[model samples]
Target chain A: MPETETFVSKIFIAGSIDAVWREITKTDEPQGAMFNNRMHTDGLALGGQIRMRTPDGKYTGVIGEILEFDPPHRFAHTFRFTHLEDAECVVSYDLKEVDGGVEFTLTSKGVAVGSKTAKQMKSGGGFICKTLKAIVEKGRLPLHVWTIYHVLKALSFMAPAATKSENWPLKGNGDAQPA
Target chain B: MKTDSFDSIFQALAHPARRRMLDIVKDTPGCNVNDVAAAFEMTRIGVMKHLAKLEEAGLIHSEKSGRDRRLYFNIVPIQLIYDRWTMEYSGWWAGRMVDIKYAIEAGTNPQEPDA
Candidate 1:
């Protein structure tokens, strides 16, 4: 049976439209972190293709031509995750000026109903929105950054095992019996 | 291990309904299933499913009292996850910046001219 799901997320970023655009459309740099790849496209205009590349030169998605484009206001496009059949979806971004920033809404439609990808799209969408907000407001990576920090802290405490030498003295060496 | 934990947290948070539920609970304490369901266009069962996911993710907790199952926010785990993920990336960026600074001081372009 065919299933369908939709996810929407909104965030208020305290920055100008140009700044947001640069971050949103960046092909390289930290802004690419949210997409997990560099967006390789000429522009984000109507009928303009939005493509992204993996570090290994693999094509992740062949984003359809932009359906809508309004600078600092809105952008919409169709996305096809190349490796997954029936993984076609529409992504739209609506931006509005708020008291201290811009309120942006990201909507994804046509996700397969009850599929793992849909479930993930729902939650991951929100995280990405929040992460973008944090980035715009604080100029930082936010949640992913925090996750990495804690993991390193935990690993730092366990690095002793890797530094251990095979010839290291055993405890109570003087009293140790011959093997 | 950390990446797995991070992935789980992200997976749990991927849902829009679940995130909205978290915000509701965070703003108001002791909200029941019905109250949460009322906030959305989805059916009670739909909301309950979202709640179940939230509960499983440790983002929220629930208890029953007098035929009412009250859900409360548990934001600590989210904060912990955020701290873990954000810090790692930031550290990497910091190291790169340091390298860039050293390169500039040596009268060379810090970044590779072209990839």
Candidate 2:
């Protein structure tokens, strides 16, 4: 069996801690920083369930339970992507107030080395942090991200009905919906 | 990202040994100082110094795991630098491309009345 590893990514966003936290925990709309994944959660509390779904509610990408929910500071969850066949990993977001802005950090553990999920997380971590920082600080996304978001929006109609939000409830059979 | 942070990041990455140390830590997460030092012919203190520089640049962070300190690379500072360049230049080029595409279409069509 491959050994597990921990990955950490951090960013300095020129914004208040509250702004950074809001972007991370935003549930009402799609977060462009998260590749247009709209967070759907039962509530913002410990032990509640959360999932990242498409903007049109047509597909679900990630599903996990909240492990920590400290407001404006720390939020941790067991992240398991629906598309990858890997063990659930712990992902935590830590926001600290700095001199002129917030220092946002993302840490993940229990990722098997060289796994597909690990590869994705390694690359995804940087882009996510960068996009989140840009969104919180500049109020916009990079041009490539903007173009990808629109393309995903345009392709939403091709999503399968089985993957729609209505099919995946907050309390499901303790298994991820296959992508 | 601040100017000094870039200075530190680039400086830390300037040395071939430091960059190799970074790659080791990045490729092997949770690796310790000794694990990184073993790969080098330099003295342990020398490796420590390079690790310190990398840590100072926010390129790697360490946590005490029992008796050993585990090191993991942090990609945020580099990502910030990347976004800084791409966002400014890419946005400009994308806008220009759109304008040029429209110009080409308009010039070739000659069908629609001029606004």
Candidate 3:
């Protein structure tokens, strides 16, 4: 019967295994307001606490810990959002060398297939995987770049007719490219 | 774009107040310092500092029209940054990874894209 566990999501990260491994294991910081500015981790070693603070400054933090820690290959932890619900799952990051580069797969299970808990877990799981991909690949915050993009887009809307006609700062001919 | 220019663009965009000023400059092309400063709660000098940053970052085009300096929003740097980060990565994460693989095989390759 399709294995009794629930796996959330996965993605491929194109980078060296050493580089990818260093990024995932080196440091831990709060991923902005999503995690209530708190992703406290005692360490990445097996049995270390991996506290993920959910939204709300007053709500009690979820208490999860490192369950598996195999450096340069696998790192799994208790993915729980106790503050939101009794949501409990196992989030695993597996890095394997493939044809081009390393493929990082994030899997989370222990929640129902189509349940709200599953969705939340998937979102979080996807976020972690994407964050790793962005860091190892782009080497910057994707959201920050995305934010600048929207700001530029908003600014472009107010451009006068001449601004489009002139294309003053652009490199090539004045085709009036869209931002 | 050059990496230094890219860094300046991001550094200039790192402020919310500067972002708001950029919006004002966009809505009012050829707007003078005073015209842009009126929207912000800070002193005119403070506002000018932010405007100067945007100008330096190539995010705004400034013109000396008669007695006043008018500013217009420039989006080229932003577009290039978008292309570099999003367009380059949105697709071919692995296909581009293939390029990295070849780069690896080709030798230490001074342009190993971060190695």
The candidate maximizing TM-score is 2
Q: Can you write out model 1's per-residue Cα lDDT over B1-115, one digit (the tens) per residue? A: 1121345557768988788888997665467988888899999988888888776555665657699986666544565555555666696897799888888887788766523
Could you tell which candidate, 1 or 2, scores higher by TM-score?
Answer: 2
DockQ ranking, high to low: 2, 1, 3
Between candidates 2 and 3, the DockQ winner: 2
If you assessed candidate 3 against the hidden native complex, which CAPRI class would it receive? incorrect
Runs of candidate 2 exceeding 4 Å displacement: A160-162, A171-179, B1-4, B41-43, B82-115
Query: Lowest summed lDDT over 10 consecutive residues: which window, candidate 1 chain A?
Result: A170-179
Provide the clashing-pair count of each candidate structure. 26, 0, 1
Put down candidate 2 lDDT per residue, A11-124, tens digits, no spaces.
777888898888889887778778879888877789989888986666888888999999989999999877667899999998888778887778888987778888888888
Residue runs of model 1 more than 4 Å from their true location after superposition? A28-30, A59-62, A146-179, B1-115
Model number with the top DockQ = 2
Contacts from the true interface found in each model, as a fraction, amount to: 0.00, 0.58, 0.00
**TM-score list, all predictions:** 0.49, 0.80, 0.42
Please list the residue runs of candidate 3 whose C-alpha ends up more than 4 Å from where it truly belongs after superposition: A1-5, A28-38, A53-62, A144-179, B1-115
lDDT of 1 by residue, A129-170 (tens): 666766676777755556764564454434334222221222
Interface-residue RMSD per candidate?
Answer: 11.9, 3.1, 17.2
Q: Which ten residues in a row have the lowest lDDT in candidate 2 chain B?
A: B105-114
